[model samples]
Target: MAGGRLSWAGLLKWSLSYVDGAGPSGAVSEEERRWLAEAVERHMMVDVVSRMREIALLMSTPPAVLEAQGITHDDIEDLLSELQVHVESIDMANDLHSVGGLVPVIKYLRNSNARIRAKAADVVTTVVQNNPTSQQLVMEASGFEPLLSNFRSDPDLTARIKALGALSSLIRNNKPGVSAFRLANGYTGLRDALNSESARFQRKALSLTHYLLSESHSDCSVFAQLGFPHLMMRLASSDDSGVREAALGGLLELARDTTLGNRSLLAEHDRLRRLLRGRMESIRTMTPEDLDAAREERQLVDSLWITCYHEPSMLRNEGLLVLPGEESFEQPPDVAGRFFEPMRRAAARRAPPVEGSDPGDGTGGGIVLLLGLAPDGRSNSPSH
Candidate 1:
């Protein structure tokens, strides 16, 4: 009975004696408890280290063996997700490389299960995000190829997006990673993503494109070679505002390129000017919430406009930047007036027809905010 029964007497005795004092009760003092906590924490961290290595070994195990052990994609995903959380700490991120977790995580980018592949990319993303040490290690492991593979052709949208995100982090500040991307035709893959139906997918690709272009001013011509100018224009007009902004940002970076090749491509030529002009004129219908959200979009549009047209935005033209009621440094009047106003007035004097608008509307190259012309147009432009 004692050996096999519930042992209720023993449990009662243990519970009653469990008080925090050095008495018959098996309770330790505060100092002893603190010491115990320190030891427990150290042991817990040790366990974490062991668990990380174990997960890494399990991930490196062949899929066939894992399947035989009844480990499914979901199981692998959960394991990776946990590893990813651990890898967010910079120490743990470096520790992951030390423990050989990073490579296997990269390897799983080619895992048969779509969700597992995506989660593996997620782990890679976490590992390499701002960690140059891990970033270099990842590139050395030839992690880039599988990531590129998933980003280019993974059937799962999430997998593609996550893989793109991982690749982005991998190459961020690593010049060799960037060179590898160029050699591996990462931009072409990004172009494919831009054409994807997923808005987030397109946005991530756009951001990465902008970064890559920013890193190498010469890449703008690569984009023009890829016909990305026209593609970017289409994306800039996307119904999704984020997609539109990302695309516009990419275009702005293209416009800033001073390379002879970019100049030959004529990114800042009439077509872009007309596109920006039409976009500037179209913002009249945005609700306040939309306008607030779209300020960055408008700013990108404004910058791209001025870059191509060599004049300030309509905001500057309207004296909003110059004649602000309060003295603020947000828009310095000297910078605004010296470079922008004279050109705007000079353009106004000529009063050219808007390139993309109806030829006979007589609205001029810029938006006309004439009273009683359109009820909503005038009010929407000046408030911000």
Candidate 2:
């Protein structure tokens, strides 16, 4: 309609304007507006389709020919970045599926170029974040396998993180997708991710784990069976507040699930008690400038302490449930420490050594590695 190329927003504005003669129409009706919007999306969608085709052509072509044309994976990565922005819109996300762009995107999960793989996964992540429609579309397209593969074993940690993020989005609130994850043995992937040397990875895994556990108590058995209880405990002590918050969220769900043989799981467990107490002690000194995660961690750790101890925590007694500036505790953790001895003895006697762990190592020093923090605090893990 103008000298420059048309955009969806511009077309819609003109077509639905109070007064218009751009197309021999005067202020189109709402019904016509809907038609016009779809038309614009399909028309502008060529930009996306052309890029997707370019990526496919470039990727499938011989390396020698690609070199001859000076095409590179960086070009593919840039195209993916553009597509990601487009798919952030619900219509474009669905349009992407309508045109079969998902297949190539999924295929790229195994691309030789790590950056392209990560970017592809990132694009998938954006596509499925809150779009259940796209989530189902991806599941139907068999997008899970490649995403899970990258998340479970991709050499590049960024690819793994992006893949994990995409997986998290793919399954969230989608039962069939979650069942697919179950069939795919997703928990093991989660366990490995939990043990990663990256805080970003740990936070993602923890968040997804929390969602899974909270969705159904039956999963608690599966997770606990995977020895995730220990990992969750370790993660509760992460230096990163985001990781700690997510870990505490998972821990809270597990504690609330009384059906997973609830009593013996974590109740009156000394190490847990001590960890919760340590978190409690810090809640007192938090300032208003502290992050929301810290405040939520305080609430979760408080609830967890109460659930595990079956009594009001010091923060609870002071009504510190809200956060800093609120007065908050009543339980003497020292008294709680007394329970640790007996439980430790009982646990040591009955609990099997965690798989792949040293039999004699009673101290759970192998804390969950978070985004940039390694087990030994020496990771070059990429930040989110």
| Clash counts for all predictions | 0, 9
Computed on alpha carbons, the lDDT of every model, listed in order, comes to 0.78, 0.79
Candidate 1 residue lDDT tens string, 1-384: 223213443443444356433246554676765665565556556666777898989988998998999998888889988888777778888899788787788777787788988888888888899989989888888898999988898888999999999999999999999999999888899889888888899899999998988888878778888988888888888889888998888887877777645643544367766777677777756665666666777778777777766767885565333232434325545775677687677767876575677745645465444334346555434443
Clashes of 2: 9
The 10-residue segment with the lowest total lDDT in model 1: 1-10
Candidate 1: lDDT over CA atoms? 0.78
Off by over 4 Å in 1: 1-41, 261-270, 319-384
- In model 2, residue pairs whose N, Cα or C atoms come closer than 3 Å (at least 3 residues apart or on different chains), thus clashing, are 198-370, 198-371, 199-370, 199-371, 199-372, 200-371, 314-329, 314-330, 315-329
How well does candidate 1 score on lDDT at residue 369?
Answer: 40
For candidate 2, report its TM-score: 0.71
Query: What is the C-alpha lDDT profile of model 2 across 1-384, one tens digit per residue?
Result: 222234555766776664355456565576777777788767666655665555555555666787788877777788788778777878778777666677778888888989989999999998888898989889888899899889888999999999999999999999998998988899999999899878999999988998898887888989988988789889888889888888888878888888867545787567788888788778766665663447677778778887787788887777667655653433535875685577666665675556787755544423222345667878756456
> Ten-residue segment with the worst summed lDDT in candidate 2?
362-371
